[model samples]
Target: MKGFFDEVRANLRSPVLLAAWGFMTAMMALAGPFGSYEQIALPRRLIVWLGLTALAIVLATAVRVVVYSRWQLRDFWRGGTVTSALSVAILAPVLRHMAEVAGDAYLIVPPGLVEIAGFVFCLTMGFCAFRHALETVPPAAARAALPMAPADPALPRLADRLPEGLRAPVLRVSGRDHYVEVATAAGVASLLMRFSDALAELDGVDGLQVHRSHWVAARAVAGGGRDGAKMVLRLTDGGQVPVSRTHLAAVQARGWLDQT
Candidate 1:
């Protein structure tokens, strides 16, 4: 149960989820579906829409917790789709009941059908919005455990900082709170070194710091793309590195942005 609440808190903390809620609220206010626009004042309609959004988020979070705990479905889209469907299923009927209790007029369709259709439509919109948000938000930094690389007599200083087995071609280095996560062809390892110090060790390496917390090898960059307002460099290892606003122009100047 504690884990369930923790997951819910994490979801709610997501900027993407919050943005979706705001967008859905505005759309509901304008569309006035379920006779909400005509039956209530603007302020009340906004409040009701906000309440519905909150309920949907909570229900979806709970459903996600169950799906993940019992079924072990970890894929983002798959879990989100299930949660969205369940949320709509539960939210639609509850909304209809609320409308009846409040004595609000039904829209063009019967109250039950109207609530179902309206909630489904809004949820769909929210899902897409959240998906886009996920694309833009940077992933959490973590090092993957893998076997070490073969010994190289001429290993660089940066390679020295890594563990014995992980001395392979560097892909990228991402800064955690107090550690630097070094990604290589062999695997990943976290070293207790400042990000700036790590970059200094790679003095002769061909790479650049794209973000405050991220530095990527020039050879490791396979392509690039736009994620909302940010530019992302796709690494050879299938990792995406976000380029901060401060270094966007520098990345573009270096032709990294032209790859994709």
Candidate 2:
């Protein structure tokens, strides 16, 4: 929840989103689409549209954050597409009902579901495309580091998933689509499986699930990588993984920080 809310706060701070919402609200109010023009006066229309859209945006943001944060979605750009589709499917009908109540308390049937859904789908897709087009990089990392620990004997289950050459000790496991990318002393290999399944194979591994999408072996963590306000766990094999706030307490409890 902390990670989700933190993402929401960052998104809400975007000036581009604020401008878009304002413009969209003004357009909806002035044009009075659906049956709104006949049922509402201009002042009332402004208030209704503003409030409705505000609520719509909040719900939309929540959906987007959830989708974008999916452990399997390593490609950030692809996440926008999923987010828009999910937002339209989830928010359109709900918003239409809100419109019905705001306009005339369902006294008259609201806009057809198809109509509302189409409008929302187009708007969301456009917003996602525009937003992603401006992105030059992925979201940055988090704070903290890891301490050195030694690995136990390699388990056959995890070893079988990797290529013969790279089946060394697991340094980290990152989720990507239906696969778990296992990083080891040799290299990273993507095993066809869910993140949970990957972790299950390494049950006795001395590591922590520091993020929804990542699991890091304690021995592999080398300290001293920082990205602005965030702390990134540097690995023995020259990799860095961000620690999500949800796992920060556990990271601390494990005495992983080397603030030195």
Candidate 3:
């Protein structure tokens, strides 16, 4: 299906993320086989070791994503490297065990502590390499959608108060006592009037009510910022509005990125 293909494209586009995952997996597999499996069949040992290692790697990636979502390249690199190193250290024995099943003899290291420490050191090195690779790849910028123009003749006339170049067809109107908030390309504003009265007096736009207090033009959003768990949209002329989590996916799908 078209949707499935689109999803595939999106996944394929994340080269850095994919590379990180791949390297983690390879390290796990290599180290796990080296550390375990004298007691079990090679196949079973391999499966158990690989599966556990993969899970650890995935968990590491998830943790990094959550903690570093907004981090700059320098920070992200440092964190990711640290994460990779710790992950490798933790998973090394498992990898060594798997490798043992394949008939490779591990060094008879003492107390297992030294092996773990070695894992930590190797992991750090691997992650550092990954970060160095990312230096060549630039991150994508954020963007947001803009509102559509309104129709009705009276709406344009009402919007006429704005500069000629700033005029956009009114999409929706809402009331705050005597003032009506209009969603236009120029930005939202309060004009003295009942929102319902203004809607009836306007024409030619299609949009939906976001809430009782606000109606966003279908395209007026440019991008947004996060305030803890909340998303704040930065509109034209530097005005900001909150986009509820309930509507966040919609905003993301519309490709709104903060320009401010």
Per TM-score, the best of the predicted structures is 2
Error of 1 at 67 (Å): 2.7
Tens digits of per-residue lDDT, candidate 2, 20-75, equal: 77887898889888867776788988887788777667766777668655344434
Ranking by TM-score: 2, 1, 3
- C-alpha RMSD between model 3 and the true structure: 16.4
| lDDT of all predictions | 0.70, 0.70, 0.51
On a 0 to 100 scale, what is the lDDT of residue 14 in model 2?
A: 70
Please give the distance, in angstroms, between residue 257's alpha carbon in candidate 2 and its true position after superposition: 8.7
Which ten contiguous residues of candidate 1 have the minimum total lDDT?
135-144
Better TM-score candidate (1, 2):
2
Query: Cα miss at 169, model 1 (Å)?
Result: 17
lDDT of 3 by residue, 1-260 (tens): 45334433433355665666666655554554343434345555556545654555454554344333223223434656665656665566765554445443433432254565576556555654564444322221211132334533644455643333435766445555455656565443445465665655444455434434454555555556786776776655345566666766666676564344
* Estimated TM-score for each candidate: 0.46, 0.50, 0.34
